[model samples]
Target chain A: MSYCVNCGVELDRTAACCALCGTEVCNPSQPVDMTAPKPFPEEMQPPPPNNRPLIAGLLAALLSLPVLVCLVTNLVFGGGAWSVYPIGGIVLFWVLTAGPLLSRKPRPVPLIALDAFAVLVYLFVIAALGGQGLIVGLHWYLRLALPIVVVVAAATLFPVAYLRRYRADGLVTSAILFVDAGLALVGIELALSFFAGHPFQLSWSWIVLISCLAMSVALLIIDRSPHLLAELRRRLHV
Target chain B: MSPLRKKSRPATAYAEWFKLDNAAKLYPAIHTGKRASMFRISAVLAEPVRPELLQAALEEVLPRFPAYAVRLHSGLFWHYFGHAPGCPRVLPDIKNPMLRPRFREKPGFLFRVFHYERRIAVEFFHALADASGVLVFLKTLVAAYLARAGGPGVAPGRLPETVYGPGLLDPAATPDPEEFEDAFLRYAHLHGPQGYREPKAYHFASTPEPIHTLHMVLGLVPVDRLLEAARRRKVTITEYLAAVYVDTLLEMQRREREVLHVDPRRRPLPVRLQVPVNLRRFFPTKSLRNFSFFVNVSIDAANGDYAFDEILPLVHHRMRLGLDKRTLAASIGQNVKPERSLALRLTPLFLKNLAIAEIYRRVGEPTSSGAMSNLGEVEMPPELADAVERFEFSLGPSFRIRTNVAMASYKGTLAITFSSTCKETDLERGFLTRLVRDGIPVKVESNR
Candidate 1:
């Protein structure tokens, strides 16, 4: 038994330094004591996230402005409806603000609702305007519904299925993040098609195809290789 | 003919073993500098060393200092060891000095020869020996030889003792292993720069720091004043100086954090310090060519402020913990192995280039904000001190780390010095200034 001279703390024979104060314990003639004061672990907390709700609300507002402007112009010049546009914009912003919170899992319910809302607003605004009249053919519905169906269904079912079906692997998490990025891109394309009114969309299809292809490749390649999966887990953080 | 290659029949060999730390591979471009370097410290005892009796003295000394007597056989078959083990020493030199060291060239044997200089010139091969072990080995070897040569003339009535180099070198006969071992190890580790940049110079044949880069400034503090200071602090002289370095680095880190807004709380920064311990307590090796290995001691930067009051006992405690005879003896046994290459897959290219860095990582990538090597309590045969004047140490920049603080004492005064390969970082400014500011009276000298 000994005491640290610097801190005056009673210590075990093996103490390298004072455990509390980091004062070196100088016991020369003692037996080897296994319990030496060792260094503490050094994992630092990340800097506090600058999470600002005001900034979030402002971002939501900014996104809603352009859609509102287009809707207003349609009402005046192209005989579009005034009421549906503002209401849809409010609902879309609400989803943008609370998508992660409201979805028990990533249901994509908000995105689907927004996609439908955008189509309805575009048709009503343009029908009132009487420029290119509101026409919702089966092809248009197929284009709009297919992506919404895949995203909403996948978002709702993937987590539950993945938990039950896929084996626990490191790469699975990052694979999921990329998959969400692909779905978000699909949502953007759908929203764009609604505003344009006349959809002669050939080239945009490639972007959707590429995003899905990349997400699948990232998943399949990462899943199969253990070494690569470890690498991905270490880097991707997701 | 060449300065580094010797004129002897059996060429002197030095082999450095670079074991990786935590089995981790290094990324490219990391600066792995030296943990410490060879203090440009030369002890000028009263008399100049005699050249005439050198070989005869070596014959008497070789059987005694076992650590200095062994020949190195590395894993690199053609370059170091023979095609088979323990082959005769008549191997031809077919190696190109210009080519970078490869796995075939690894398990390096640093050939050392104490020839053709008023002071013994130890010509070292690239991969084998570090500066501290080699320098102490050189000093001990020559001192032992001198002791033997001046037999009755110098040895007085002492027996032909070759069992331990440090023991024989000490005329005072204080067999307190506890007190001296720490001093020896501190001295050994302090011989090079504090830290070196790794990955940057990860080749065995990579250029060492410019020899001129290491410089010294010496001053005299009477033996009594130093002794008083040591007594006042209830610490040894080595402990007092070690405190200064620990404090210096701590202060430097503190100041840097304050100025640069570095969050010390993030991951407590490390400023590990290593000091070389000479293994003269257990046995004597006569050659004195490679006599010491380092005992490392480190203090985290955030632990406390740099104050002598806090630092003194800290130094004493670390020294006491590390220099226990059993630990030291085991360490010596572990380090004094005849050279052999590690069995492995393909040799990592980094290992070939970064000899010191690779070794540093193995030796616990000492995250010393700096190092302090104080070669304490050196005894100059009374007649030699008059001719030699004083001693101070200098070392090459190490692998991975950046700065070092080195000192050695003679005639009771300690010379404190710093060296760095980094032209940019201000490692020496704050702490060294503190020493002078607190009235320690540091005299500054540098090659720059």
Candidate 2:
């Protein structure tokens, strides 16, 4: 006897809410008939279970095989901590490939940060094993590699954070990405110049920065103006 | 003899097998858990359905449908069918009717029978049968159940002769050989050219429901009101409804442009519908295997905004032209010619699967915005009709198209069911509200 006030169609007596709009029934004249049989049964079919964790576990076991062989060879042969390089490389690869699969809901920020940390550790292992003094290796690592990795991670994480915080449109996303790229290039150049003992000055990075800025501005303009956006879409459609 | 005891028959008793028909060849390659090529037909009786009786009825009537009695088997070049070993257990119906059948699992059957309250439904994988064939199977199954249940004042043996009408066949009779033949291969003229391509169609961009969850909304309308509305428009019910669907889609596209600001480049894509035509009407064939083809009727949104009136004739004429025997046969030839090619026949099943999947991606899924299938009015003998309250038909989820419509009318009520995987109900609301405005009363039901 009750009808959805929103859709104006008679609702089935068994329905507590309108199927189309999900509007709750609130008719005072007639209450929902709880005893009426539903159109469908109550049993629900569950979806197929997730297989990512099992795959990740298998990958972990497969990856450990090479690591084990390298360790055994290092132990049998009288090598001086040489296995650290190969072992570090394998660990880094595993983290990059299988890390996301381990978690049910992957948070991009932490995963990317972990990946950056792995790369830094692998590079440090290589530098430490360079036969150079530990002091020298540590010096270069802090001066050059650390800053570069930090810059790349920042470049990736900034856009992701912005996207997650405010679900931006495609044009806005592209604009933010362009700006992030420009800044990352500047940071990389500064780290390189400082490492080589040259004065911090913009070189080819200026061209990339200028180009990215111009593209970002143009995209923003198109995004703001409907007519221009429509025109661009028509011409550039796939 | 109890049909359940008949299950102990020797394996030799059910040895017949079949090839995947021309129209059926595409389903096994393209179907996925999310997008199963499945459909359902259900009949609600006046009284609660007894599970034990329904199960026995299925066993008795299933022998009459040899095409539906087998399990899918893979061969070198194509997937075929072999006789399934045991009777498929009748399960309690789920809120979501048709979950894609995992053929490797137990009961390896292509179809399932389910009972919920008064309703007895059968869900079929498209490779088994089209809606027309499934309807016949369902009708016979229900008839058998009724005979066993024996309603008041009715005796099983003394049932009227009229009870076995065109739809309900005798379960004791042997199945006609013509019933399982591939009608497409028989009717196709191989001289026709290969497939024709159309511009890509517009698709709704909406969030999808979780896997295995399908949202169905049924709008029940009086058949007389719908027929009268179609008559006023000088078109058949199918034509009128399709035009309305196209118009609704066009309006949704317009709203997307004005409100959501969709990229204008997509404006050129047409709002096309794939309306499945039962070829049995065009060419006389008793073959129950897949003998149906779809006609793509569309309106280009870039041309201009179209009123409902303008869309009607365009859809009507396009349907008439597409349903012609020559056009349909040519389309059938386009599909069947590949099966006949010596090189293709020699190719491994794995390679053919890849090629077919790619072709469907390029030429099939993109060509239609959505699909609408009208099973037309279902006719049952008076005895069964009075016992059965209503009948419903619904299409399963599609790979690309988010929403699809299926219409089946029985006894004076027409049930227009929209099966969708999208989270948004805007399309269903727009469609049903439009009908309500046109003076047809609709009572809404759902498995939300």
Candidate 3:
């Protein structure tokens, strides 16, 4: 007997609110019959449970077995602590793959930070072990390697954070990423110059920076102009 | 002998295996956890459902539906159906019906029977049967249940001659070979050109509900008022409803454009609907297995803002042309010709699945914005009809399309149910409110 005043459709006797518009029933003549059976049952079937974390945990355990074997072999044979190499590599692999799988919602910024830290730890292990002719002890790691990893990680994290915060579409995301790439190249050149004990000067990176920045500017212009963006989408649609 | 008293046959009489029908071949390949090719048909009885009697009825009635009594099995090249080992148990209905069936699970059948309060619903995997076939299965199951419950005038020995219409089948009769035939292969003329590909259509943008959650909105309108509206317009009921749907979609798109601040001159994509036609009507076949095809009807906003009246004839004639036997047969031929390819038959099942899934994404999923399937009016003998109040039909969720419409009428009430995975009810509201505005009274209910 009751009708949704908003939708103009008759509401079911058991319905307390309008199903279409969510308007509360206020019929003075006929009150909602609470005891009447609902059109559908109240029981909800839960979705199947997710097995992703279990699988990821099993894979991580399998990965750890190799690290354990190498460590035991190195300790028993009395080798020069070479077990650190295998152990560090395996740990780094686990961080990159299993870390995201374990978390409920893996945010890009935190995952990237973890990965960058793992890379740095692996490099530090090599430096500490005095890698044969590859690393000049801690000096090369501190001056060149540390700064490059930091700059690259920062460059990667900036755009991801920006995109997530602003909810940017394809064009804006590409523009931001391009700008990050241009800045990272400049930072890498400066790090190299500092490591070589030369005056801070940009050289080969200038061409890359100019090209990347120009593309970023063009993309931003297209994103800002609705007419141009629509034209481009129509032309490039496949 | 009365229809209910007819002795039920044993399941051993059914063939052990069956090839997936022409239209059915795509569902198994593309079915996923989120996108299950399933639909439901239900009958609302006049009294509360007795679960025990319903179960007994299911056990008796299932043996009559051999096509529905099978489980999905994968072959080296294509998926097929094998006779299920046990009778599927009738379970209590859930708020969310038609979640994808786990074929490996206990009740290995591809279809399930459920009852809630006064309703008996059958949810079928589309690979098993289309809506028309499922409707017949549901009607028969309901008839069997009523006979078992021994409602007044619905005694096992007393039934009207008209009860065994096209929908309700005699449980005692031997399984019809015609019902199991792949009508597509039988009717296809392979030399005809393949069906043409259509341009991508526009879909509404909305927040998706969580996995396995489907929201259903049912709007019940009197069939007489709807039929009168269609009669005045000189179009069939399907065409009239489709025009109203297109008009609503047009209005929604305009509002979306305004909110997004898009250029007014930018041409909007066409609003296309996939209207499924029962091929059994056009061709001479009693196959209850998948024997249906869809016709895509569209209106482009780029042409101009079209009024409801303007869209009516366009949809009406398009449906008239699309439902022609030759057009349907050619579409069927295009579908069946690939199954006959020697190289395709030799391809591994995994590779074939990949190819079919890709084709569906490119061609099948993008061509229609949404689907509207009308099962039309369901008829029953007066003895059984008095025991039934109404019937309902609903489509399962689609991977790309968020909302789909299904219509079925029983007695005098037409239930137009909209099944959607999106959180927004704007489309359902617009559609139902439009009907209300057009002098049709709509009674709205939902499984919120």
User: What local lDDT does model 1 show for residue B356?
Assistant: 32
* Model 1 CA deviation exceeding 4 Å by range: A1-238, B1-223, B263-265, B282-293, B303-306, B329-363, B424-432, B437-439
For candidate 1, give the DockQ: 0.01
Q: Once model 1 is optimally superposed onto the true structure by TM-score, how far is the C-alpha of residue B308 displaced, in angstroms?
A: 3.2
Among all candidates shown, the one with the greatest DockQ = 3
Clashes of 3: 0
As for DockQ, the candidate ahead, 1 or 3, is: 3
| Tens digits of lDDT, candidate 1, A10-29 | 44444455433445656677
Instruction: Report candidate 3's interface RMSD in Å.
Output: 0.7
Name the 10 consecutive residues with the lowest summed lDDT in model 1 chain B.
B90-99
Q: Score the docking of each candidate (DockQ).
A: 0.01, 0.60, 0.69
Candidate 3, residues A1-238: lDDT per residue as tens digits?
9999899999999999998999999988999999988988889888766666897889889988998899899989976888888889888988898877876665889999999999998998788788464447678888888999999999999988887888775777888888889899999998999899884888888888899999999999998787998799789866
Poorly placed runs, candidate 2 (over 4 Å):
A22-29, A55-238, B1-17, B152-166, B262-268
lDDT of 3 by residue, B1-448 (tens): 0111213223343479878888888998898645679999999888899999999888887888888888988899888899887687889999888888887776578888899999999999999889888888888888888877866567765345667766788776677777887778778777776566677788888999887889999999999999999999999989999988888898899889989997775568799998999988888777788999988889988887898999999999999989988877777878888898999999999899899999998878777888999998888777787888899999999999999999999888999999999899999999999999999999988988
Q: Write the per-residue lDDT of candidate 1 for residues B1-448, one digit (tens) a residue.
A: 0111212222222212222211112211123221222223344334434554555444443333223333323333222222211211211111111111122233322233332223333333222333444455446555555555443245523334443344244432322222212122222221222342311111111133432232222233345565676787798867766676666666655665677675543334555667766555444432233345455656654455555687677778988887876565545433322122353223544444365355556544444444566656555544433434455554445554555566666666665545554543244545444444444443332333
Q: After superposition, how far is residue B274 of candidate 3 from its true place, in Å?
A: 1.6
Error of 1 at A123 (Å): 52
Can you tell me the CAPRI class of model 1? incorrect
